[model samples]
Target: MTITPQNADDSCLINQTVPTGVMSPPSEYLDEKKQLPNQNQNQNQNSTSHSGEDQESQKGRSRSIEDATAPLPSSSSSDRGDDNDNNDDDDDFPEGGLAAWLVVFGSFCSMVCLYGLINSVAVFESYFSTHQLAGYSSSTIGWVFSVYLFIVFFFGVQVGPIFDRHGPRLLVAVGSLLVVASQLILGLCEEYYQILLTYAVLGGIGGALLNVPAYGVIAHFFKRRRGMAVGVAATAGSVGGIVFPLFLQAVIPKLGFAWSTRIIGFILLFLSVIANLLVRSRLPPSTHPVRILPDWTLFKDLKFTLCCVGVWFMEWGIFTPLTYIVSYAAAHGQDANAAYTLLSILNAGSFFGRFLPGFLADRFGRFNVITITNALCVVTILAFWLPAGDSRALLIVFAVTFGFASGSNLGLYPVCIGQLCDARDYGRVYSTAVMIGSFGTLTALPIAGALLEIGSDERQGWLALILFAALSYAIATSCFLGARVLAVSWRVKEVY
Candidate 1:
């Protein structure tokens, strides 16, 4: 990772994909130029003196045209916004177009269907504990959501390759069916095992199927504008987070769980229709299709290793607040409606958090912006969330501030990964890192719930959960900074 000055391409800056220094002309071309002069000299000596002057002028013109028309470095072309073949090379990405914007919109809809429900896990967790799955330990209840999250992330290992080799239409179509089916089935589950199967297992698989393609497709259409595009797509998660919870809160009492879930299923069906229509691969299939397997050799690079680990700890920490924010409010004496409202307010802040960071990350450095956001995550959790006891205002402020800071976890992580390697290798690397991070999601909620069991009282359990989340984010921040230093040293202004 310690690059020398002459090796400018070794720098991890976002768009520095090719060499910047002037290159020497090929030796063969140099020799041809050399032989042309010698041939002219020989001809003049051998009795072609009259035509020598004309030949010399023609040679000079030929060399001038050769020098002028020679290809420059790929980095220069990329920066100049030159559009090349969409199928030929990742460097040839069309930065934006009507078709590309449609893909982003489709991705937005996908996020709303998949991640939206994830954001509403708190509503389900709280409702199940008090109603259908009453008398269950928090740990048992936590598994339902954890499994959903783990599958959402873990299954990308396989989906990424399939999307790379086969394209996204089939994957999105099937995923849409499964996701809609899971919701419709969820309406009828009255028992614990039934709920687990419908909501967690089935929904998890469906999410994995669609979610990977939503992200993987974007890299096909963009490179320079990727962070902004991803940010815009990711905001749907927050929109879903806010909308699902509020809708459930308003209607769950009036219509009950069965009817509420059925309505959500119908809503998802409409969105999936859009995703199926618009999301697709603009690039052709990979020439050497990457196998559906993890590349163990990637760990050799210290920066990438840290990137993977940072995402793991990020998943471990971030979901704690998102999953338990509603429950915490209710446990601490907030009104039932106010408790659900807190989740909406939190996601409202997240709406901006996801959106603005990606736009900023594109202008500033991806690493710089992400590192700052992770730091904010740590500071907000320890400073505002951990200390907010029964004070409604403090909890509300924590919800908004922490939500804003943590929203970028999904929005910008892949962009940060793009900083580590060339665009051609991006899909594989991102999928592998996400697969590793899935372990953290699988275990985080259950572990947080177990921490609840160890506490003597509800208040102690809540504090322990808060402390765990804060510590995890602190470690994740350190890892991100470590990766940043390896990539760009201590230059805070360098955009990676």
Candidate 2:
């Protein structure tokens, strides 16, 4: 069937509501089931003679379902038969091989440009709120970043389907242009609305476009090693997170914010260009038509639906700390510059946090790893961050530990969702989750700002913020447990 953009999006929403196994039932089975009763009766009369053919057909259907549902296996008997198999070596991921590593490298570069910029948004908020956009309320400026995040996620509802139909090549190309343009324009905008339109809406759209391709391509290359592959690629965001803040610190002083932003835009241009070239899907081209709409029906699967909810709440709580950490430090007698530096420290820890835990997760189970990491984020926030409002040492520790723990949220979320459906439907599944998550992104920042407004002191704001983080963790934990129940109910010792 031709999966048009609209149909693809519709499918994404549908995938959420329906089990992938049911939606794309073995096409062969559907075809066979449609055969004439006369043919069936003839086959039944010669049942013994046709038994081998039936068994072979059944085997083929089973293999198709397995490939659709899980990581496609590495080897096939066909590999030995294809005389002109130029792709023989390319079929299976090399795991630690140079090509796989190169893909990982490319993925890292992509994340640095996309996720790094996202994590560093707080630095912009901290600086902009007190400087050029000072006339605007914190709530208004918060909307700028919030809108950026929302578009980045919301637009994915469309981008994911397109990626499924066409490979990442064209989408990445257009996204690269949009992102670079948004940055260049953002450098020139001095007005509140201009910043809102350029940075929040435009940059967000570009980021969203870049994001799906960045992580989605990993699925095409590696299956068994997917967790580690995605984790390694995910670390690029932390690299960007660390790099961009340091870039801002140096550039803002010498060139000032306007030119500094322009320089960063140029850097994004370079990275996005490289990303456009390198991040590619190894999977054969999809024959599906271009469908761009989100399929809300995918939520019908209680496990996936719960996962979407968990991600929504997780993202909502995530940016609260990212956006507010510097401001919180500044309010607590920390130097403004020093306060901004704390984000960098947190991102630095996030770098390793994204990489190492993925390796662990591959062995321990995706849901299990995510549950533990999320718990760590909540506990660390409550134990260290909540009380460390005035203690620079404690806050720094919280930042590093939380960064490490939370890093998994970004890296493993896609894989966790991927676990529930067929490989071909991954784009739809992921995009649908992000569609729901878009609402959370839209509201998280503004809500955090409102929380700050309610408190007399920033310390109280920190408490409220930490509570938000903990609540999200609790919700995420329940979702993970529910998924575990669906797959392997109440068996605590059983690996998810």
Candidate 3:
């Protein structure tokens, strides 16, 4: 029977056939006239008319049933056309513009609030576990901060897709509200579970929501410059890390944790507002009804997969030092006041760590910068931190140097992953890494706590932490090298 398939495009069809049809020569008689453009059009129409008869003749004569059940001409043609249309759509994007850069700046500010405080949580944890919450076990108190961090990255599986579907305005707005609430309630959290539920889980969710949008919005506006833009934006988190610790150090003693945390929350609220105003996707929401779920298929990308593994190891051990350094100092030998100052010094080094290496990554390669810096971190822990006695000068050197190296690790991971995937898939890739890294944060501190317990002394615990940092960095270095091998082969001289 004759069939006319769906015609979705306005262009004249170039080819056609019936489902059962055998291939045929042009029906127009072979003549000089056939070469004319006008004759070609006439031949196309005549071929359409003969389609059914051609199908029947071919079906009965052909030996293969597969030939008889072949696809229809219009269906095949339309499929090709549709594929082209999708490609065209995928190719369309705004790589960079004034408004897009502004959005990047806005994203930077949002990250400062969401991730900045998070980076400084060690300072908070060290101080609180010793002072106000000194009654709580280190492991128990750790749970409070772990849950906070866990939520920040864990819930992005849903939040990311939601941002893709609805844009950042409402998502960021809600995050702002939740984050502010977290800070307000945090002031009242005297019990362990209250802190866990309020700061760890609730604040984490808020930060997670804020984070995906913070990075995802920039992806919408850039492709070629995505690395630089995201690196610059991400540096704000470190800036926040730097600023908040110093800010808190000054205020917490004077104003107290409740008022200090509230002030930081207010700062976050202001940044989130700016983020809501600026962060935007250039394209409309995708028409396909799909949930934004973390696809493990990302592992198929060898470089990306290795990078994720490296990040996991880096995060797991990175926090051990971050959370324990102040406490370690205070408990072991240094004055409490001096110990707190160490956090500020670490963050100060981190400020340049996050920014300068990012600029360097653009010139070198993301993996190259990450591996070298991470290796430096491993060495510093082994060489400097291990032998650090009550010599305040040595500890200061270790903190600043390790802080700088660790800063490079933070700034480069996302940029490296962004290199691996299409701009649109960045949120999924980023969140997946964050999701996996969350577990690292959840366990690193507790493990240090347990090690401290093993020795019945804070000094032994500090030794375990130094060991953890050294080993974790060693693992990270391996993973990064593995990724480097995959990307540029064994060419050790390659910049990537």
Q: After superposition, how far is residue 329 of candidate 1 from its true place, in Å?
A: 0.5
| CA lDDT, every model vs. true structure | 0.77, 0.73, 0.69
TM-score, ranked from best to worst: 1, 2, 3
* TM-scores for candidates 1 onward, in order: 0.83, 0.82, 0.79
lDDT of 3 by residue, 100-148 (tens): 7899888887788787887788678877787668898888777777777
Model 1: CA > 4 A from native? 1-74, 77-91
Residue 249 CA displacement from its true place in model 3, Å: 2.3
Candidate 1: tens digits of C-alpha lDDT, residues 1-496: 2211111112223223334453433444232233243434454344334444533322101122233224322332222122211112324567788999999999999989998988888888888989998879999999988998998889888887777778889989999999999999998998889988889888998999987788877877777677889999999999999999999999999999999999999999999999999998865565436686777766777777898999999998899998888888888888789999999998999999998999877666566678889889989988888888878899989999998998898889987775554444456667788899999999999999998778567878888998899888888888888986775566544555
Candidate 2 has its poorest 10 consecutive residues by lDDT at: 1-10
Clashes of each: 0, 27, 3
Q: Write the per-residue lDDT of candidate 2 for residues 36-104, one digit (tens) a residue.
A: 343344444564455455443322112222233355343332221212121112234455667657767
